[model samples]
Target: PGGVGRQLLQKPTPAPAQHPPVRYPLTGEPRILFWAQNFSVVQGSKWVDLTSQTFGAEASVDVSGSSWSSNDSRLVLKYANVLGSPLTATFHMTSRWFPVSGRDWFQLNRLELATPSARPTVFNASQVTAPSNYSWHCAHLSSLPGFGAGLRGHGPSPSWGVLLQDVQVPAGTPGFSPGSGRGSGREGLGGVLAGACLDEPFPPP
Candidate 1:
């Protein structure tokens, strides 16, 4: 008599642990448009002037893309040699959410200057010499505003610098040369130099 073979029941392997998506500080090739009525950069012990001559003068920097979440409150930008130095300059953005306004307002909290010889030298907002009238904005390729409209605004300016995340210039716009990392020789009034585009990834904090 042939013995009946019993079916072996094997336990199913548990599904891989589901993890939340990772969030970065920035995403897409966004251009950071910034301007200030008056500002300065600390060079050694003294402060170097980097201001705009006119009230509405501005500069921009095109950055590479990163994977991020919409809930992130921090954005970091890294540019190599854009400051005419071998080290890379990192801009750290800090934001606060306003439920009443249903928007997030951010500011340039600090600037990090990377050095080949040692760790980055941290520069706070005050150290950057940004005057009380300093203003800033951010633009993305997917959500660029009309030409010259990104910086146009009405009413009194905010006390803190605002990073307009949804403003940008098209690839072939005048005065903006993609992939060149250089401006159209139109430096801001106070030597606020334009930054070159760099494909660097800066993760969110």
Candidate 2:
């Protein structure tokens, strides 16, 4: 039989209303992660309405979570847009996760994580999980440089556009949506998404 082809057809684990928490380096903030292969929408608005902000899916998702340590982080502010003139429009965001006990937002979250220019990495339960207790499946997207993605790095890419399998949003925080696009990869070590560029705006449509 076609083992590889058959495996592809298999069903996915019904994600939990609350996906398990993952702790990124430095900041031990907790974020909910998932493995979304693809996502699309067929709302009423197309280009004219959206460009003028007339109406449609102007949604947002607040990602906040706590890790085993003190670190906490919030990321990816999403919204629906028609890719108007100004290419950049808070399409998505990434922020830093702090290392503390209480709660706080990260500083170096960066802008690419949420933007379409962002990378396509994978996150598998085998990679980010703790050595002691691993429960969820592993997922990876593009890779960022400097931080230390380590031995687990899957060498640059995958066969298709890697969806936002799962994120590390806080348990209670909600999230936003920017529709869809092809993501890029960060060529560094442990360079996860942080939220400085996440809130900025780019070109004009």
Candidate 3:
């Protein structure tokens, strides 16, 4: 009986090894970074002035140590609150087991938009923050907001993300105090009068 059982089971074949994909000529990860805007809860329709000093604020997420990859066909990147953190998401991929470096065609963006809302994982704060007072002052900002993937370049060619990496925050930018946009004393704050009381280490919100 033991001999007959051995014959019933056959050896299985192994899968082929996958290799790293080559980037498009002059094309690669978007390499773009974005900072979400946070602001105070003021009454009435208050136009968030980008010119004057914003009392306290920051971009959506820290853009330092950030990069992108188009190779993530089925990848679910999370918008992390911390710099250099992986973009995490409840990826609704058809499968998880992929050959290493295999081009898995998964819809990561669709998975994110499929849900009602996206929850904050790291940079969760009770108060609000704002973007930079000056439009061009941001580390990776050009002129407008990005689309699904990121900032599209000019013409039919279309541009991807082109923000600077490893950007550091100054006293007046945003997301300094409270680690969630409460530092009012920083310099370029656009008209958001956070005058005086800057000697303290942390913010006073």
The stretch of ten residues in a row with the least summed lDDT in candidate 2 is: 195-204
lDDT tens digits, residues 125-159, model 1? 42121111122312221101331122221233211
lDDT by residue (23-141, candidate 2, tens digit) is 22213332322222222211133312221131123323332321222243333323344332222211121233335533333222222212355443223322222211111121222
- Residue 81 of model 3, lDDT score: 26
What stretches of model 1 exceed 4 Å from their correct place? 1-31, 35-42, 45-62, 65-85, 126-205
Tens digits of per-residue lDDT, candidate 3, 1-205, equal: 9988887886767532222211111133322212213211111233222211211233232223222343332222223421222333221222122466453322212222111232322211111112222111122222124311222333332111222211112212221332112334224342332221111222332
> What TM-score does candidate 1 reach?
0.32
User: lDDT of candidate 2 vs native?
Assistant: 0.26
Candidates' TM-scores?
0.32, 0.19, 0.18
Residue-pair clashes per prediction, in order, are 5, 73, 25
**lDDT (CA) per prediction:** 0.30, 0.26, 0.24
Model 2, position 101, has a per-residue lDDT of 31
Whose TM-score is greatest here?
A: 1
Q: Residue 149, candidate 1: how far off, in angstroms?
A: 29
Clashes of 1: 5
lDDT of 1: 0.30
Best-to-worst TM-score order: 1, 2, 3
